[model samples]
Target: MFGRLRAWSRRHSKLVDALVVSPLVLFCLLTLDVYKSGPPFGRYIGIPATLVLSAALITPLLWRRNRPREVFAVVALVCFAQWVADVTLLPADFAVMIAMYGVAARCTARWAVAAGLVAEFGLLLAVLRWDFSQLDAFPSMSVFVIAIWLAGIYANTRRRYVESLVERAERAERERDQQARIAAAAERARIARELHDVVAHNVSVMVVQADGAGFAIDSDPEQARRAVQAISTTGRQALAEMRRLVGVLRQDAAGGEEYAPQPGVAQLGDLVRQVSDSGLPIGFTVSGTPCALPEGEQLAIYRIVQEALTNTLKHGGPGVRAEVDVHYGRGEIVLRVADDGRGASAPWVEGGHGLVGMRERASMYGGTVEAAPRTGGGFQVVARIPVGVAA
Candidate 1:
């Protein structure tokens, strides 16, 4: 029953405070006349008048509970007035105790200490002035003073606990949001890398076929028709793969089933043929015995080669001779593509999307790529992939 009431009071705090304080004020006002009627200053109307004034002063405090400094100031003023009125007025001094607790919890520690000191000293002076020679009053008054100081201490401790809980909750929320952002950024980077490899490889092949068709159209009709057919087939294959890759961005759950088998090492011969038809004088040589590899490793090797040849075709000048050498071994596979062409004027010039894509693919397979101008002439790209390693 008490817990329910406490929860209800929290939900309707303004209503609860009004109901509690309004009746207490009225009762205190009615009893003030009785306390002051038999005083030393008999029939001195000042005592009842002060009580009435105190109640009026504290009524505003209910509305300003969160403004602890303001509430403390007003309640302290009322306590001073009651102290001057008579020691009998001490029973109505509970308002000052409540305000002291609020000051400790919401305001600075210095303010809480100052308020406690002022109230204790004023009460002691009031008792001495009244000359009440009752030993029983001392114990009760001491208990009341101790309770007020303890309430202030408890308020300060509780406030610290509440603030700590709030700080921890905010920190947890920030970390959750940061992790979500990191995952989204990583996904976008993967998509961009895949698109770069797909577009670069397919577009380079198409450009070569179109050039071949143009040259053969006037000299040999049969060869021109074959080149056109190759261009059409390459374009269609690229379109289908692009659709599969782009489907990754779709939100529909059913769209996830559209994934097609991606190219792997088995397609290396096909990749070589496409490059050969592109008009650059090229040769492909295989060393060591061939063996099967994991699907991911195969795909990685294919992308690395595709990116290297694309770079060669774009940057390697006319009549350039390019060589692709694949060495399949026991524990690793080494692939190299080198071009004897006009090397870049600034050898240290940064690479573009193709180079970055190649590096990313090689890294995915626990491998590395080295692309630089050769000592004799032109540029060389070497990639090595470790096979059958513990994942």
Candidate 2:
């Protein structure tokens, strides 16, 4: 309830202030007969003159927050007029100190100090004009004025400090959320590349093996059984790889699926054999001595090769011939896949998701891939992947 009230008060602060101050102003006007002797103006007009001056002094406070400097100047002029005419200090006289506090709290330091100095002068005039017989009242009034000024300066400084702290905290939170979003996007892309490699290659092999099994069921019973068995093996492998990828998506560390090891360059021969079963002949060659590499880099090379082969199978015309070449250098590994077919569209030029995925994977390990049409009549994919000694 208190929190709600504070919010509402902030929204209608000027109205609230007027409600509180209006009564005090009325009281000051009611007690206007406190002083009997003053300049000719006060004596000639009597209570009406005192009431008018008191209202003028207090009414300007309603706009103190919105126009603090103007309010203070106007209040100060009325105060100086009252002092010169020897008007007695009333509760409405407190408006001058209130105006000074507003100026201090809402404006800069130089203005606050100026307002404080002006308020000090008014304090002296108020002390002389007020009907206080005790000498101690003089020192006490001065202390009260100084305390009010100090409070305003402190409030302003503290408000600015808290605002800065809140801004910094909000900025840090935004950056943290942005980083989380970027990491999630990167992980999703990685899983997508893995899923494509697993399903496309394995499903393609299963389809080919099923076709072979159908062809040989009556002509060669033994070849038909072997084809069916190969299909089973490929299906099981695909399921396991899929489980691992799914486990990664769920972030389930306890799941055994995610713990499975990823395949590397050593699996290339098997990959080649499976792809060739679709009636496309492909060649595999290694030009230099091999070296072990990080799991991430190895995965990148494997996926790039897999995507290239899949593209060839999909777009290469009938009776396509493909070749894969790998070279191990002192500090880098290079892979090249070339196909002799009329129908394969160059990925870099044509623009496809598979080629984009390959590039994203290679860039993670600081490598590069180029896919374009071969000069004569085919498609070629070449990648240069830097390496570190296997850990």
User: Model 2, stretches more than 4 Å misplaced?
Assistant: 1-74, 77-91, 109-151, 207-225, 251-259, 277-280, 287-292, 343-349, 389-391
TM-score of 2: 0.74
Residue by residue across 25-111, what tens digits does model 1's lDDT show? 776667666654466521244665656666655675585456777887887776676557543453356677667666766666787
Candidate 1 worst ten-residue window by lDDT:
36-45
Task: Return the lDDT, model 2, position 103.
Answer: 89
Q: Which stretches of candidate 1 lie over 4 Å from their true place?
A: 1-20, 40-48, 81-91, 108-123, 130-167, 253-256, 265-269, 280-301, 325-335, 345-351, 360-369, 383-391
Q: What is the lDDT of residue 296 in candidate 1?
A: 74
- Candidate 2 lDDT (Cα, whole model)? 0.81
lDDT of 2 by residue, 66-145 (tens): 88899999999988987787665656778998899898988899999999999987776565555355546767878998
